[model samples]
Target: MPVGLSMRLISLLIVFLLLLPSTEMKRPGKGKGLKGARQNLAPGRVRVAGRHSRSRSSRLVRLPNCSESTESGEVFVDCQDQRLTSIPASQMWLKEPKHLLLARNRIRVLNDMAFRGYESLTSLDLQQNQISLVEEGAFQGLTSLTTLLLQHNRLVTLSEEALIPMPSLRYLRLYDNPWNCFCPLDSLIRTIQVPSNRKLGNHARCAEPITLKGIKLKQVDPELLCKESDPTGDPMEDQRDSTNTLKPSPIRSKPDAIAACHTYFFPQMRMDCRKQGLTEVPTGIPEDIVHIDLSHNSISHLKARDFQGARSLRTLNISNNNMEHIDTGSLAGLLHLRELDLSDNSLLFIQYGVLEDLYFLSQLNLGGNPWMCNYSIHYMVYWLRLHPAVRHSGLLCHSPLEHNGESVEEYVNSYNRECPKDRQHSQIDQDTDPELWQTVMEVQREVEEELEPSHLKAPQKYQIIRLS
Candidate 1:
């Protein structure tokens, strides 16, 4: 009777075993598959080589202050001011971030491989950091970078090769650093002067060599930086020996003076001494000369008595000279002088009151001078503003990065004279109407011509004849 019951139970067990699921079915959701393993792990967990499993929170977590976004299969990172002392190597995971902002941090030095593989980076901001040294090739792979901001850092100098990789870089901010303007900085100065380097203000200023401090790198004469070989003779002995041999010689005869300079007696005694390579003003010129063209020479200084005999001189062309200093009273006796051309000179400083006596001065050209546009040049700005007829367009500032490429008029207008504690006076009033000054100058010329000799005055087409 039990044989049938045992046989039915065996059949039920076999059916139950057949209905149970196989091991392959359990493997899908049991943390064996890739998706299952990922889901089983906790959020922000990462497995690093040769280290125990750790959560990202254990390390410096990049907060929302730093952000990332995926666009066009590339990630862009913004990690600005996250108190980051060094750039995270994890950025390599991005392959090549298109935009990175690491500015306003405490990054003291950038290693050579800082951006080794970030070739797709188009913009980078490292401004307002403590980056004193950027190792060569630090930005080697940033071929697509168009903008870089490194302003307000401690960088004293950078090799030309550091920027060679960034051929596409169009904008750079490198001001507000203590730049030593020695020979190494000449290349950078020339680079900034390139027209394509737009918005980069004048080259950095020199902070060393007390004599050159506060001077723009572009303004320093290249010859001043040259290292001359030691002279074979004792400098003092050579000077004394030469002085002993020098004796007062007789003055040049009148014929010799005229022969030295190309002169003309006709057309109101015009003297064309231009391009003669003369270092000093020629002596023994006729007193009746009205125009003296001594331009394009190598004159470096002008004494007060240079033109004492040329009191009747109405025009003096001294352009393209190397004149650095002119005595205060150099132009005093030229009462009739109306036009004076002193353009294209290497003048660094012009003594005050040098132009005070030129009351009838109508035209003055002071362009192409490496003017030190600082507090000391306040008087010159004030004078130019007072007389708008002066050619102010060509008066570009060569110093003070903030005022680079700015005209003298624009600089004077924007300059804050009150910024200097020692400044005694406030900014001069620049509201003088240029048109009104032009009218006054025209009237003054008419009055001066009436006082001149009839032969010196312009010929009139008609004359007034009165018979009584």
Candidate 2:
């Protein structure tokens, strides 16, 4: 009896173990479902870098966040504003891409053999990047490339060997960089200055050796650049690595003004760059901008043609800044300007011809400034006198103890009585209205004749009259 019972118990235990294994297999696995949920591998959605243990094949697909599109039967890979550190050509370039745009990235160097397989590419945009070094063989395999944009970088010069590979290249942009204007830049400058390369380096200018600063590469004489050695010695600038062919200058290439500043289309086409700490006015402002607020900055001077492109601007606020001087013709293009603010600045006076371009200006704010009521201040007052319709204020004296705390108008009146200026100056000279002055003189003569001839001569009195 004991043997039979023990044998039956062992048979029941084997059956129970087999049933448990089959039951677990038939039921759904929770871990597998959660893994798929975390990846979210849905179709038509863009994928980002993931923390999952990737396969060897997937590691080669670490491309920038891009959205593919087709135009004119050509494939375009736009990776703008991706915060990318390197070009996507070597990592995940398409087979037959015609355009590979990587604008506004953080790419700082272009090593040799960079775009090895990009032979079919026609246009490559590298503008608005922080690229400092571009080795000689960087464009080795780009035989079909036509357009290359390198504006807004930190390149002091470019080697001519880099251009030898790109024979089919036609359009190039190298503006907005701090060009060193030294011996190494001679070959590149001479190449681009040729009439055949008209569109190559249009607006690129030198930034070092103060004499050559602000001079365009096209206008510079290539023969003279290398003719003189380091006459000025090494430039007093940030020291760079000695191994580089061309020194990487300080990054002064300004970003796109429309992108750096805030733009609003509704109500009015305006750009608000208030408190941006801009030392100089940025270029490439949209031509359609109507109002611009550049107040609360560190701009100490306004260069000539600063507002050259903003022809449609109506209101300009440059108040609350360190503006001490505005070059002649600085505001040369604002033909439609209606209002301007110069309040709360370090200006002692306004120079002549600075406001000559604002033909239709109506309101001008000059408050909160320390205007010195000197002879140089006459141009501003004369301009206001001619444009009587312009509503303006803040013309007060802040120096010359005798004229301090007095309105500029009162000081002008006193100065005219004491030390008069010429009539052509638009000053309120008595000679402007000859009839009025002649009548006063005749009345005084008649009074003198009646008093002195009849009895004792009484002293004639004349009152100083003020005119605008």
Best by TM-score: 2
Quote the lDDT for 155 in model 1. Answer: 77
Clashes of each: 0, 0
Q: Candidate 2: where are CA atoms >4 Å away?
A: 1-60, 90-95, 229-468
Residues 1-468, model 1: lDDT tens digits: 599999999999998787666644666555355545546556544333222224442222333356677766656676777877886654334345777777678899999879855767787878668998988778887889887777667877776677888899886767666876556655666666666776443435556544455555545543344333238532223223333333223353222234345443322457778887778787766678889898888888888877767888999989888888888888888888888888898875467878877767778878888877776666666565556564433567777777777776566655653344224113323465776655554565554454345687777676534353
CA shift at 215, candidate 2, in angstroms? 0.6
> Where is model 1 more than 4 Å wrong at Cα?
1-65, 70-75, 90-95, 200-203, 218-468
Alpha-carbon deviation at 254 in model 1, angstroms: 56
The TM-score of predicted model 1 comes to 0.37
Q: What TM-score would each prediction reach against the true structure? A: 0.37, 0.43
